[model samples]
Target: MIIPKNIEELASYAEKGKNVFFFTADWCGDCSFIKPQMPEIEADFPQFNFIQVDRDQYIDVAAEWSIFGIPSFVVTNDGEELGRLVNKNRKTKEEISGFLKMVEG
Candidate 1:
């Protein structure tokens, strides 16, 4: 996964395909915990492209996307947001995968 700090950076990844996803902030406890587990999750789901963003660094971007919290996972295809999981205290590979599958499938 790569970290993109701004919308311009995100737009480039969007050109690649529908697998583009953005993870918001390091401050969210869930995101902090999820960080360590992401490598394994990436390994299991090799088809997706992931990007990390700081909520504070990109507040405008988050608002434009209607993100209301940190620990948000905005799954997008091309330029469309498929589905998002934003800090409901659920963080697990299985749980996240099920959410993505619901959107991507």
Candidate 2:
């Protein structure tokens, strides 16, 4: 996953192609659990570019996207958002795969 340093870099990714923006924070336990499982998820969905955004590092960007929780995901294609899975709860690998499936559909 590409870790974007700022909003501009994040935007640049979506502008290039379809991408999944994963919002997370270092202090978030749920985010930590999901981190290791992301590689498999990425493998399953190779069509979409994955970008990891640290909410703490880019507070304003997270606010702009209305991502108030850790472990949130948003699918975007050329800067247009297609879907999202945003919540405060911990997510399983299955749930993450399901979200990608939804985006594929």
Candidate 3:
């Protein structure tokens, strides 16, 4: 997953191609639970670029996106939002894959 250096870089990613902004924090247990499965998820969906955004580090960015929860996903394609899985809950690989598939179509 690509980690944006700044909000501007993140914006550029959103404008370019299919991108999944994964909002997470180091201290978030839910985030940790899904961290191990991310590699496989990326492999399964090669078309989308996964960008890891630390919620704490990018509080302003998260706020801009209205992401109040950790371990959330915001999908974008060519600068347009496709879908989102925003909530304060634990996510499974299947759930994440389902979200990706839904947005892909």
Candidate 4:
């Protein structure tokens, strides 16, 4: 599993290809819960890119992207957002897999 260090890395990923993103903060309980399980997700989708953005550090980026909740995900292709799973306890590997299937399709 890949957890990006900062927004620059996240954008660098976007420049390459379609990607899967996770917007999370180190202090988030839900993010902590899902961290270990991310390998399972990575094993399933080797082509997708997973990124992490610190909510506390990148509040403006989060707000600009309209991410009002923690543990949010955005899947995009060619700079267009195909789908997003925002909060709602959708922080599990299963949920992430499901979102990927829907958006990457």
Q: Write the per-residue lDDT of candidate 3 for residues 1-105, one digit (tens) a residue.
A: 999998889779979899999999999999999999999999999999999999999898899999998899999989899999999999999999999998899
lDDT of 2 at 30: 98
Clash pairs for candidate 2: none
Query: Which residues of candidate 2, in runs, are more than 4 Å off?
Result: none
Instruction: Point out where model 4 deviates above 4 Å.
Output: 1-7, 88-90
lDDT string, candidate 4, 53-79, tens digits: 777777877788888888888777767
List where candidate 1 sits over 4 angstroms from the true fold: 88-90
lDDT (0-100) at residue 55 of candidate 2? 92
Tell me the RMSD of model 3 versus the true structure: 0.8
Candidate 4 all-Cα RMSD: 1.9
> Worst 10-residue stretch by lDDT in candidate 2?
5-14
Best by TM-score: 3
The local distance difference test score of model 4 is 0.76
What is the C-alpha local distance difference test score of each model? 0.72, 0.90, 0.94, 0.76
| TM-score for each of the candidates | 0.82, 0.94, 0.96, 0.84
TM-score of candidate 4 on Cα atoms, chains taken together = 0.84
Per-residue lDDT for 1-105 in model 2, tens only?
Answer: 999766778779967698999999999999999999999999989999999998988888889999978899999988888899998999999998998898888
- Among the numbered candidates, top lDDT falls to 3
Tens-digit lDDT track of model 1 for 1-105: 888766788668766665645556655777777778778777766778877777778787777777776566777777766788876574777877777778777
